[model samples]
Each structure stands twice: as C-alpha cells, then as structure tokens.
Target: MTCSYASRARFHRSMTRPFFSKDRISHFDIFEKHAEDALNQVKGRLKEGYPVDFQDMVCRFTLDSATEFLFGKCVGSLSAGLVYPKDSLPGQNREYANHPSNLFARALSEAQSRSMLRSSMGTNWRLAEFWSDRIQKDMEVCHRFIDPILKDALERKRSTKEGEQSTGHAYAEGKGFLEDTLLGHLVNCTEGKADEIVNMLIAGRDSTASTLTFLVYMLSQYSRVLKRLRAEVLSTVGNSRRPTYDDVREMKYMRAVINETLRLYTPVPFNVRTSTEAALWPGVNGGPPIYIPPNTQVPYSVFLMHRRKDLWGPDADIFDPDRFIDERLKYLTSNPFIFLPFNAGPRICLGQQFAYNEASFFLVRLLQTFSSITLAEDIQTRSPECDKGAGRDAQEKVIVKHHLTLYVDEGLWVRMGEASNSDDV
Candidate 1:
C-alpha cells in the first residue's frame, strides 16, 4: 500500500473515534503514537534501574494498538498500562484479552513454548499441528475481541438502515474495520476474517517491540553513538514539542541508527519457504539447481545474511550507525540479500513503513529525555549469563531463539541517565 502522510493522519483520527469507519488496516495510525509513548515509558524504566522487558511491553503494546485499530476501542493494555485486567471475566479474558497463561504473556513465554513444542513433538507433522493450533488460538482471540464490537456496530447499522439512502445496497455507516470489510467481503471470506486481522497483529507487535528493545540496548552499549543520535534528534526535532511524522522522516542520523539496528539484531531472524519448482540460489557455482518437492521447506536465515562479513566487513559486529552514512553504503554492493530484517522477495513485511515511523519517533523521544544509556553494574555482572542464550557472542548478547519470531531469552535491560547538558554533539 502506498502510505501517505494524509492517509496516516486520517487513520490516526479514525482510530480515536468511536466507530471503526474503514475497511482497510491502518497500522501507521495506531503505531505512531504508541511507539513514542512506549519509548518514553522504557526510558523512564531504564533511568529508574528497572529491567527492560521488551517482550512483555512489546506484546501488550502491539496487541492493544492493533486491537484498537481493528476494533475501534483500546484493549485496556496500552491506555490502562495493564496487560490484562485483573478483574476481567475468566473465559472472556482468556479469549479476548492477552492472558497471562497464554503465549502472549512475555517474550520468554513465546520462545519457550515454541522451543518445547519443537523438541518434544513428533517429527512427522508437528510443525503443521502447531501452526494449526496457533492459527486457531489467534482466530479465537480475534473473534472474541471483535464479536461484541461488530454486533453493536451491526445493530447501529440496522437502526439507520431504513432511513439512509443507499445505492440499493444495505450497509453500515458507523461500523468498525471488521464490519466495514464485512459490508464488502462477507460473501467470499466465509471464515473468520477477524482472525486474519489478529494474525497481522501477531506478526507485527512482537517483532517491532523486539527490534526497538535491541535498538535501545545498542544505543546504550555505544554511548558515543547515542550522543550523536541525541544531537541529531534534538537539532531536528527540538525539545519544545514532540516530533511529528515529518520531523521523524527528516532526522537522517536517527534513520540510519534504526536501519543499523535492524541489520544487527533482526527480530525475525529467519523465514521458511517451500520452492514450488527447481530453482538456483546465489553464491553456488554454475547456479547449481536445488531440488525441492512441493512440500519441502526452505529456510532463509536473515540473521546470518545481515551479519555476513562479505557484505558488512570486519566491523560488521560493531554497533556503528555511521555505517549507514551515504559515504559508506555508496561503496557497498547492490545485493538485495545483504539485509533482510523485514525480508525481501514478494512476501516482505507490509507494515515496514509504519514500523519505521513508530521506531524512529520512539527513539527520538527517548534520546531527547535521557542523557545517556549505560549497563548497570548488576546487569553488567550478569552479562555472561544473560548473553548465554542471546544467540551470539556479541558484547550484549542475550539468549535469542527462533520461535515463530526471534526473541531474547530474558529481556533487554539497561541503565539510562540524564543526557549531556551541551546541545551540540
């Protein structure tokens, strides 16, 4: 979809309104605000010596934001600052809200669930079964969350149906995204389209959250880089007001910083696809043919490719946002596969632009408030233990695992302090 500033603004306003008025998913609208708010919240936590739990915060933020956009009401997570309402109805809470017992609880919960399922499962069709269950669970949550809203919307539609002039078509005027779409696609998509929306939320929230966490951690590790980033943010965005979308777009250094973070700590580390026909991959001599049956799985490890020494050089492991400077990337090869944090090919992430806006806005807000980010003494002592599961031998490794998406075994914890008083970097 071609995302326009006007379109984003419209979606943002639509989400805050009582009725879900559009038939399309407007992720940019929902993510823009929450991303900045989330950064501020995380920065506060860091300054107070609170452990950075990206998984829990990301899951809840993404879920609630996506839910609000899809259903036209806050999920009570983001606005209320609660994962799940403690006094909510039990069965309803499990189905509609993010349950503590569910995989939606934290990053570790999801990682561990996938790990256990992978290890103890039957090799024959375990993956298929797990995927099926996951889909079912996603559908259940979507339906429960949207059903009541949809019903109310439909009722409102019916009340205004007789009086309103239609193109000989019966439709709901003040319906949410689900109802608006149903007004059109109720014929073809006989199954739960609500689940489809949930699937999109599932795909978006955690990955973005994980990426932001990594970005913050990296900023802390490279304090000097964070200083430059803050200078750039302050110069471009200023401190008098929060940044707008346009301000975020103009901050070149902040943009590069986020791009570098995606390269180094990709949230979705790998993607699997089955080749429908015999195909040739790069790097092999003579373009050697690789055989694949219809159902054969092909794994493309993005993490490995992003950290490829041939593409990024000896300093590939270094957290240097300057690598993204035009002078640097200009000398780089034009290979598309060099970086795939959001994937490449036909099935790349659709919410890429929105994610960028949110991440940038949040980072800008964070740096504006904090002077510096450093590793706490206690956190530093546990670095080895934390890094054990973090998937690599980097200075800030934490156990990272590929469940459905990549997530740290623990969380991204850091210490943030006041920024340098000097406005100039």
Candidate 2:
C-alpha cells in the first residue's frame, strides 16, 4: 500500500483533474470572452496611435481569466483603466490601479520575486528573512484580497448542504468536477482545512501570463512568422466563429509557435529537487557510483537545457518554430527529459492543458482582432540607464532575466495596427 502522503497526493491529483480537463475547459467560455474584452481594449487604444506595453496587457488578461477560472469571479483588469505610474519602467504603460485586485496582483509579483531569490540562495535562503518581510505582508494582503471570495464559497457549500440550489456545484457535479469549481473542489477535497487558496492564486496566475508575454514579444520581432500564424488562425478560426478545443488542436503551426515559445523560454527556468533520503546513482565517465546524501537540493536549469547545442544543434539559440515541424521532432519522443517547461513525471502541472487552451483561445482572438504588431524602434535591453534617453542605443536588444519565471526584462512594448484585410471589431 502507498504511504499516506503518496495516497493524499494521488487523491488530490484525481480531484483536480476534472477542473483542467478539455470537456470542462469549454465550459469556461468566459476565458475566451475575457480575453476578447482585454484584446479589444488594447486594439481601441492602438487604433488611436497608442503604443501599449503588450506584456502588461497580457498580465492583466491572464490575471482576470485565471481568477475567474479559479474562483467564479474575475477582476476585470481591462475595465479598471489605470495608467502607468510615475516611476514605471521605460516601456511599460500605466496599469490597472484598482483596489483589492491591484494589491493582490502586486503581492503575487513580490512573493514570486522573493521566492525565486530565496530558492537561488540555497541554505542561505533564510538570510532573506531580513529582506523579505514584505513577502509576509504581501501574503497577508493576498489573503485579505481573496478573503471575501473564500467566505462566499464556503457559505455556498454550507448552503448547499442545507439543500439550497447547487448552482455553484451543479455544473461540476454533472461533469464530475471535484467540487463545483477549482476552489470548491479543492476546498471539498481537503476538507476545508488546507492553506491552498493562496497556493492556487500563485499557481493559476504567474506561469501562463509570463509565457504569453514572451510569446507576443517574440511574435512582434518575426513578421513573416506572425503573418503566417495570422493566416492560419484566420483560415481555421476566422471572423465568423469562435475557436473550439479541436479547432486549436488542428492549428498545427500555432501549436508549433507556442511550442517554440515554451522551448526557447521555459517560464520556470530552474527547478530544485531535494532528496528526502540518501540515494546512489550511476556515475559519469565509467567512474564508480555517486552518492547523494539526504537533504541535498539539485538545481537543473531548463533555460540552459532547452538551448543546448548538442541537443538542438548549432541553431539551438535561433527562434525558428519550424524546427518543431522539421528536424528534432523525433528526438523529443526518444529523449523527453531535455525539454521540461512544465516539468515531467508525476509532478507535471495539472493546469498544463488548461493553459494551452486558454493561450490558444487568446491568440485566436488577438490575431483575429489586430492585423500587425510592430516593436518600437526605440526598444532596447532593460537596464537602470535604459530609462534615460541616452541609454536606448540601437545596439541594445531584448534580454531574458529570471525571477520565478523568465521575462523580457525591458518589457514587450509594441504598436498594433488594424488588419487591413479583416473586418473591424
């Protein structure tokens, strides 16, 4: 028999599976609608000759949709209509500065930065206590921000127990979701005792947003690729209808672009594995076996592994999505360990498919709405000096930096022009 921890984890996975399943995913049409609302907002601004920071737009879009998927409500970041702050970065635009949601989003960013820094510090991570008091305060803020939703969910569950209408849990129950929605299923599965609400907030928000941010940035830099992608999206999804799960699956090129995006810039660049018990493994170069004592943490860099010259050949560093369609495709089936954006084995992300569905839907909506995106001529690598006029030299290029995930340090600022061939939104 499996141990309690193992069994509990297995049960949790089973409980959560329904929430991210393809069938249940379509029911979350709100994801697509929310994506459209955000995109249209940006498209209107761009039509008026505004160059929007696409990364921040993606962040708000993902935040609103993910929260809606997790809870039954969304923050409506697109509706907040806030501008960039006084000390904002060079390319970033004004953001939605609403209450609760704004504080919640800020807290998420802080906790992720601190968590990344702390993990990188190894055993010295505790030293961050002096610098990371803000993380604690942020968590408190996040909890407070999410508190009312939690209470309402709990009360709804309680009401259902008293034979109240099961609108909250009805769809999930009919479709075999764990509880009703993600929060409901998780709350029910853990007996309403776990501190998982905050965990879900972090898990549901960051990774997907970062992926889309980088993907849009990369798309802007490659017009030929972008043109082809839009063509495929138009042919497959078109102006008349919305894209379904099968429609996205049939989008082979779109799939390739997203795959390449994940390959080149795996959001969570490094993951740490800690051994709970002593272990021995085969040694390298015909040497004797190596020993790994208990409590040892091994860090593997997905960012480096994804771009290995030997694995991907000389053009490993290149941004060619066709590589997925042409060469090296077979190698993935033979050696799956080399590319681990969402990780592998038993701990693979439960939301992986959900993320894919959401992203594909958003891309479909975006390409359908906007014809072309142009990277600003002044775009440059992010730096303290980049904020000044003299710092944006022609030589500067986009650079990747890591915190909880890899993000374009300077931000992806682009100008979107209406598609001449397409009907107006």
> Top model by lDDT, which number?
2
The digit string of per-residue lDDT tens for model 2 on 1-425 reads: 12555576677678777667667776548776777677777866666555777777788888888777777678666676433322445226434444556677878788889877777777677765865464788778777767777777776656555543535344333233225478777765655643555655566676777788778877887888888898898888776478988898899999889989999888888887777678999987799998988777777789889988788777777788898898668667678887788888997888888878878888888888777777765643454443355322321346667787777665666778766454432
**Overall local distance difference test of candidate 2:** 0.72
Instruction: TM-score for candidate 1, please give it.
Output: 0.71
Give per-model TM-scores.
Answer: 0.71, 0.85
Candidate 2 backbone overlaps, count: 3
Per-residue lDDT tens digits for candidate 1, residues 1-425, read 12353364344333323222222433255665666666567666555545545555666666666555544555545443422212334213544444432433443334435544554453654656754654446445445655776565445555545435555544445433335432222212233223344444565566777787777767766778887888788888675457776777788888888888888878777666655555545545667565556544576778888887778877777777888885568435466568777776545565676677667766776677677766444533244554454334746545555566666654544556655456455
Model 1 clash tally, residue pairs: 9
Q: After superposition, how far is residue 151 of candidate 2 from its true place, in Å?
A: 1.7
lDDT of each: 0.58, 0.72
Model 1, position 223: C-alpha lDDT score: 75
